[model samples]
Target: MYVTTPDEMRRIDNRAIEEFGIPGAVLMENAAIRTVNVIEEKYPALFDGGRVIILAGCGNNGGDGLAIGRHLMLKGAKVQAFLFFAEEKFTGNARLNLDIYKRLGGHIELVTHEEDIKTLKGSIYQADLIVDSIFGTGITRDIDSLIYKAVDMVNKSPVPVVAVDIPSGINGKDGRIMGIAIKAQHTVSFGYPKRGHILYPGREYTGRLHVVPISLPQDSSQAVGVKTFTLDDKEMAQNLMERPRQGHKGTFGKVGVIAGSLGMAGAACLTSMAALKGGSGLVTLGCPASLVPIFQSKMTEVMCYPLEDGQKGYLTLDAITGIRDFLKDKDVLAIGPGLGSKCDGLEIIRYILREFDISIIMDADALNHISRDKRLLSDYKGSIVITPHPGEMARLTGKSIQEIVASPIETATEFARDMGIIVLLKGAVSIVAHPEGNIYLNSSGNAGMGTGGSGDVLTGLIASMVAQGYSPYDAAVYGCYIHGRAGDYAREKWGETGMIAGNLLDELPLVFKDLFSLKG
Candidate 1:
């Protein structure tokens, strides 16, 4: 599904009214009806003569609340509409709805001053549910302090709140909260989900989301280009990498992973084990010669290579020659998981970027090395995937961590577009951006996946997908989805607090099993 910005949504709405001939009043009525349906379907108990207080503004969102009040009244419920603006300020579809609601004997109250907030506290306390229509997606500034008092009162109330379009005080273009936003139990959006509905902080406030088709023609949305989308479990399950019944070990593809130094040996072990568990036919863990015995003792399934090292346990400049020889039969190379930065290691990364063939998943210390000279990525020819968390992304983009975290989707998209590479900005909501300008927000994973070596598991999984013939872009998308899903599985088995990176690796097979079963 498309996730549109507020401006894009406005353009689409205008196209619906002017070009498609869907009247604005008709759209408003439809939006209100859908919100009513959500309340009926999800909170049927609200219809048992419970008091519903509609906190309405003076705009179309308020119109939606007024229309909903009329519908709730028809359902034999005690509905009260509280208009925040003066009665004369109502105009457009909002005015039409308010007039109809009043003509239908719907009780409307005014909350025009600071004193009105104190008077409304009794109504708020007595209500079973509140409809938050104070602001809509077009709101771009902080709300006034007077409105803040009312919002805070509603939040403090134990009543369930349902929001229309989006929660008030949320930036529609971005998910940032404007002063304060309504904490809604559910949000019924018209036509499609807005960026705020899916983006952070906003998503947190938008309890549950239901996008209703409010008479807007689907083609109108296509008229305005939509390149941003999110991946769901069903789609990912169906599009997962294929598995042939007659497939042999070699049919799955081989992955070459150069990771781990001395103290960070766990990074290498986790990456190699995850690659094998992620369905790679073979996984070779190439580490410093000193770390080989450690890995050999740790995982019997993964093949091990001890390359010549300049340092005691890190892959040095000399190791690149051996890695080149090792890549002869490998389908994908996954570099940089705990491979600490040293002078020789940086030189090896530079060599790999310029000289490596086949797809490469550059992550961890490798990304740190490239961040020093981003120009190394300027002329790279092969398929490339960069997995960087916010801190790593900050280093790569030369931006502050706060800047990257505030707008992960934009940061990932811009970097991918400029570098001509796939960039997966790992976060609570992982964003996968293709060089072609398409961006995907992953819908899987949980906070428990933040454990150490978790990124290494993602690196291995992505490389495994690439080895299995997925394009670098698809690999990143599917890799993030699967990695997150596995983390969720691990969390389910062992609570989120106890789950570790190895648990995520252990659950990869279960995640793939479900995906493959979906294909059948």
Candidate 2:
């Protein structure tokens, strides 16, 4: 399923109308009907005959509320439509909905001034439920002081509030609160979920999410492209169930990971160990010749390839050509985390992405190098995946980490689709965006994963998944899920504070069992 922003949603709507011949009004009506189901199920008693107040703005979101108001009133509920923007503020289908609603004898009220707000206070408090449709996704800038005060009143009010689409006052693109936001007990979302519904702060504000399909054609959203996606265990089971049996080591695939340097050899060790644990049939850890012995001493399972070493046991471009042999018959490749890109790491990475045909996972310094020159994206010849935490993604996209954090879902999705690569933007509710505009949101992992080397493990795990049979999207999604689950399991034994990336390597078998054990 795709998680999209307000603007991107509009594009989808436009494509539906222009290309698929689905009219705008038809979509709005469908949205209202679909949302009605959630409303009915959650508050059956309230919708029967109790007083209901809908605080609606002058947009499609408000239109959805107004349409619902008509339905509830016809069903014999005492419904009051609080039109926040008055008559002149109405536009498009919104205006049409209000006109029809009023004509149908649906109760309507205006909230124009502070006095009007005070006048409605008693009704607001007495109402069983208030539908917050005011200032939906269209609200990108800071709201007026009046609306801010209203937000306080709504949150403070004893009446439970339900939000339409995204929570009112949320910047859907970045999940930032626009001045203030509605505190919803439930948010009825049309089509799939949105970034604000999944990303933090805004996610908390969204409350319980109720997703409804609003009669858009099958895959109709594909026209304008969707950049956000979410993954659950159902996804893992689906991917796992699809894997063929009787697959030999060659059929499963191999991954060559070029990692580890002076002090970061632990990164290589953990990543190599994790690659094998993550289902890679075979893994070769290509490190500076000096590190090979250290890696070998640590693990007999992984093959350690020694590259030409230089001063103080580091890798240079001189040693990059040697990586070619390891590439033979390799299914996927991962670079960075511990690879000393200081000498020729960036150049080596550039050469490999430009020259190698295998699927790739770029992380840590590799991401940093690409941040310096995004031109590397256009020059690449094969399927690609980049796992960048907020900071790294910010560096790669020239956005501040603060900005990205506010809307990791949107920024990551846009960047991935725009650059034509699969992007795993790591953080809470990690987002996976593919070049085709499909996106996946991960639902696993815990706070225990907030440690070093977790990312390196993820890089290796994703590369392993890609090598084994997963698409770039599937690889990133499953890799993050398993990585998080490993952390979760580790947390159970070691507690969040004691859990570390190395702990995940030993717990990988447990994670695999949990995944494969799930019944259809």
Candidate 3:
């Protein structure tokens, strides 16, 4: 589903009003009606003489609350609205709704003084439900003290709240909390979901989001160029690769993985095993000469190449020729998992990037090497996808981990566009960004996938997709979804705390099976 920033949403609203000739009041009315429908459906008894308190500001969001109050009053509920601003402060559609509600004999109170706050607190304590429309997506400053106290009282109250558009005090574009925000039991988002509804603390405050249509033009979002999307199961299912009935092993794809060191054999094993599970026909692991015996014994199906490690248990400058030879017949190469951050390791990566033209996936230490000189990626001749956790991304971009986490989509997309490569920024919500500015936000996976070596499995999965004829961008997007889906399956079986990277590998087949069935 496409996720819009506040500015994008405004443009869509403007198009509906200006080009489509839909009146702003009509849109507000539609939003209020849909929100009331949701409230009635979710809280069925609210209209049966229930008491509802509305905390409304002087903006369009407050107008929505007034309209909702009018609807609830018509439904035989006792509705009272507390206006934060003076009654005369409301303008436009908000003023229209306020007048309509007042003409319908709805009770209205002003919440400007301390005595009014006490009354608001008492009403909140007694109401069955509270409608919060004090602020909307357009809020650019911190909430005032009086409003903050009122919000605090509402939060402290035991009554459930239904928010309009978005929860009050949330920075709709970036999900930042402006001073304070209301924690709602349900949020009614009109047209499309805002970024605040999906990202961080705003997501936490925005409970049980309902993206209801407010009768805007169907193509309004497209007219405004909204490109960011959250990946869903249906889309992923439709995009699943079909298995040919007469296809042979050679027809599938070949994956070449160069990973592992003396003590990090698990990384290599997991990557190669995940590739096999991800449906690579021929899987090869090119490792340090000293680690080949360990890999050969642990991974029976995977072919192993003992690169010239000089018995140091890690790749060196001498291994470049062997790597080049190993990747000559491969459709895709996955580099960097468990690879040490030695100078020789960096040299090996530099050589591979300079020489190879195949699809390459860089993770772990390879990303570390590139961070020392990001221009290395800009100069590479082949398609490259880099999977970096927050720390690795910080090194690669020279930004703080906090900054990357704060704006993951921007960070990933900016880097991808600048470096001319696909970037998969790993986190609770992984972001797959293409150089062309398209972004896919992953909605699968649990905290269980935070274990070590999980990213290696993802690297293999993505490489497998690329080998199987997916474009680099598509491969990265699909690979992230499938990887997280496998982790979700693992979480179901082992719980979040107990699941490991190997557990994710074991679940990959099941995820693919489900996807294939979905395709059929």
Mind giving the per-residue lDDT tens digits that candidate 3 earns over 132-209? 999999999998789999988888889999999999999998788999899999999999888888777788899998
In the range 156-245, model 1's lDDT, one tens digit per residue, is 889999999999988887778999899999998888888888778888999888889988886766788877777767778788767798
Error of model 2, residue 94, in angstroms: 4.2
Clashes of 3: 0
The numbered model that scores best in TM-score is 1
- Badly placed stretches (over 4 Å) of model 1 are 518-520
The deviation in Å at residue 316 for candidate 3 is 1.7
**Which scores greater on lDDT, model 1 or model 3?**
3
Q: Each prediction's TM-score against the native?
A: 0.96, 0.81, 0.95
Error of 2 at 69 (Å): 3.4
Winner on TM-score (1 vs 2): 1
Q: Number of clashes in every candidate structure?
A: 0, 8, 0
lDDT of 1 at 73: 87
CA deviation > 4 Å runs, candidate 3: none
Candidate 3 local accuracy as lDDT? Answer: 0.90
